[model samples]
Target: MAALGSAGPVLLLLAALSVLSVAVFVARLIALRGASAGAAARADWLDAVEGGAMPGAPVGGGAPADRLLARAAALLPRRPAPEALTAELEAMGATEVAALGRGVRTLEIIGLIAPLLGLLGTVLGMIQSFRALELAEGAANASILAGGIWQALLTTAAGLIVTIPALVGAAILQSRIDRATDEMERVIGRAALAAALPRS
Candidate 1:
């Protein structure tokens, strides 16, 4: 608490940065989770679509993933070749995955840059400490020296607190991206296989 108080303007700036970073992180988390969950639900959707289910009929009031699968099904012509079918499915999956990635890069950047800003503050604080020492002429003022050192350490701590969560959030979102991509791939593979099956 004292460290933050001693950090003065830099502390406030870091606080603001933290707030913005957290907001971005939360937004990205929500988006990635929603996308991944939707992708996971695609299995049942693909099954229903392949079974001649009505286009608009609820796959048990299916979700966004189901809707996306339905769209892809419509795109696959009655007798599309495996190669063309694969291409179309890949394109659709890429589009959905890209949407899930939105704002993730910003969170990563915040994680990286916040620490640099804190380091800058640390440097400035150390300089102030040395300047005060010089003024004291071989007898540094304990109060001034302590104040400067406090500022240096506090800024660094603040930076780390902000950065750690941001980095963690980025990692989580990245995992979600990978999971979503994998799910989409699986769905596409199943769809292509069904399309290629021989009709009795």
Candidate 2:
């Protein structure tokens, strides 16, 4: 606690950013995990839709992918051309992809800024060390100068500690987003193909 105080305000800011990054990561993980877990169910739903069991109304309450597939299934029967229908599905899927990616850019920003904040702390620490030496005139107090430098470097280390994990978490979350997107495309393609087929 004392060390953090000595490291100055930038350290506090980085700490807060670290907390926010963690929260975003956890929320995204839960959402993506839920979507992935429901993959098999989504596939089953797509198969049913292709079998011509269109629901009487819009289906509600399922994974994001399932909901998107349901919406596309409802829209498929309107007999839109395959190209136009595919384009519409892609647009809606893009929206869902964007929703899954919320807060990801914030995490990326934190990762990029944390290291710069650490460098700033290093500069500030060096300034304090020089100021201490100047105060001592010809007889510089080595211990005090070293203490000041040590405290300053603390913020840089803290910044790295926060940055590495935040960036790693962001990467992991991005991969999940990509996976979800691919699944959505596949489901949409299946629905579109079904719509293009002639009824027996």
Candidate 3:
């Protein structure tokens, strides 16, 4: 607590940002877990679509890819133009991808700024210590100078501590998004294929 007290306001702000990062990570993780499907599940969905059997009604509570397939299937009977249907699917896919990516940019920004905030704290601490030395006619005691320097460095250390984990979390979340994106594309492609098939 004392160490944090000495770390300065910027460090406090970084700490708050770290908390926000964790919140975003957990929320995104839960949302992605619900929305994403494994390879086997995806294969099953594609097979069902190709067989002219939509996996489920266009209701909620399925993987995002499955939900998209169901929605497209619902629209198939109207026999909309191939290009028009494809365009609509593409737009829906973009929306799903966007949903998966919410809060990701904020995490990335926090990861990037934390280090610079720390560096700023370090510079400020050094300046204060030097100012003290000057005030003391350049005869400031060693302990005073050392203490000030250490206190200033505390923010830098705190910044780094917050930064590394935030960056790792961001990377993991990004990979999840990438996987979800792949699944969405595959599902969209299969839907398009199903639409192209000639009716009996």
Candidate 4:
């Protein structure tokens, strides 16, 4: 309680950032894990449906990629021309990938700002410390200045602690989205090629 009371408003802001960073990281990680795990399998299903002449079924996996595939499967009945099919699939794929990217930019923004905010807090703390030392009329010792400096430095540490995990989580989530994108392209390209072939 005393520690909280002693902390400047900047430290409180940093504390909020730390909590927000952790929350976003955890949620995005879970969502990306599910989406990445389902993407390959859904791709296979989509390829089999469009290329291998297998009867299509609803893709019930609930991932973004799975939903995209499900939408494509639903379109099979119309026998869309190959170019039209490719365009539709490409558009839908872009949308799904974008959907997966939700909250990712927030992580990136938080990561970028946290350290700078910490530095600002430290600067403010140092200003307060020096001002206090001046007001002490030469009565204050080195220990008082030293304690104030350390307290100010605490904000910088807090900022870095929030930033590191947010950045790492953002990177991992982005790579996962990239892999799913590759899978979608591979599957969609092959399907388009197979559909363009003359029937047996």
Task: State the number of backbone clashes in model 4.
Answer: 0
* Descending-lDDT candidate ranking: 2, 3, 4, 1
Query: Scored by Cα lDDT, where does model 3 land?
Result: 0.77
Scanning candidate 1 in windows of ten residues, the lowest lDDT window is 54-63
Give the Cα error of residue 113 in candidate 3, in Å: 1.1
lDDT string, candidate 1, 1-200, tens digits: 54433356777888998999889888877655555565534666667657755244334323334544665667554767767787887887777777777877888888998888788778878888878788889676688788788889888898899899888988888887887677677767777876776644
State residue 171's C-alpha deviation in candidate 4, in Å: 1.1
Q: Supply candidate 3's per-residue lDDT for 131.
A: 77
Where is model 4 more than 4 Å wrong at Cα?
1-7, 38-54
Tens digit of per-residue lDDT, candidate 3, span 100-190 = 8887888889889999989888887788777777888856799767866986788889888888888888898889889878877887777
Give TM per candidate.
0.81, 0.86, 0.86, 0.85
Worst 10 residues of 3 by lDDT: 53-62
**What shift in Å separates residue 20 of candidate 3 from its native position after superposition?**
1.5
Report the error of model 4 at residue 23, Å.
1.3
lDDT of each: 0.73, 0.79, 0.77, 0.74
lDDT of 4 by residue, 142-170 (tens): 87677668767887897898888889988
Of the two candidates 1 and 3, the one with more favorable TM-score, higher being better, is: 3
Error of 2 at 152 (Å): 2.4
